[model samples]
Target: METTMLPAIVQVLPGDDFTVYAYCNDGAVRLLDAKPLLELGGIFESLKDPAFFRERLTVMNDTVAWDIKGNRDETCCIDLDPCVIFRTAPIVDDPLENVI
Candidate 1:
């Protein structure tokens, strides 16, 4: 199956449960859990620090990214592919919906 890349991430909101609320340019929202990735270690190890993990999230290169360099250098940055994230992340209901 051919897979197309999802829209760029416009916003990323961190949650208490190691999940992130990602808003895409296409008007889709998804909840992504980082726990599994964090367990793989390596660069992801730095995310073990809750404060650093939650506060350093950013949207870069059309995907979810983190600036671990503290200086905003690309060298210490990590990003997840939007296509993959869109496919794997759980879909979230739009809170703006009005219910009677």
Candidate 2:
């Protein structure tokens, strides 16, 4: 028997501060911070450039992906696992916190 995978990403919206809001097929929205991942270096190094990072964000194969070449190929593509993304904590902003 084979296990079934969860719903894929339906949409991705890139935000400032290297954050992305992802909407999944499961009817869930998740927030992912790329700051930490960018610190890991390697292929992620290229993403340190905010412009490059934001411009290439896209939803592919039910996951959040970035294709450096914009060709949608495996070689220059970087993706975040949908399962892990779904489990990530969402970013919440409290407007009242700024009030004194």
Estimate, for each residue in 11-99, the C-alpha lDDT of model 2 and write its tens digit. 78887799888877766667788899998999899889888888988876668889879888765688888877877747444323487
RMSD versus native structure for model 1: 4.0
Structural similarity to truth (TM-score) of each candidate: 0.82, 0.79
Best by lDDT: 1
- Model 2, position 33: C-alpha lDDT score: 86
- Residue pairs with backbone overlap in model 2: 9-62
| Model 1 C-alpha lDDT per residue in residues 52-95, reported as the tens digit of each score | 88888887776788888766776568888888888899889754
Instruction: Indicate which candidate wins on TM-score.
Output: 1
Q: Which parts of model 2 have CA positions greater than 4 angstroms off? A: 1-5, 91-100
* Backbone clash count for every predicted candidate, in the order shown: 0, 1
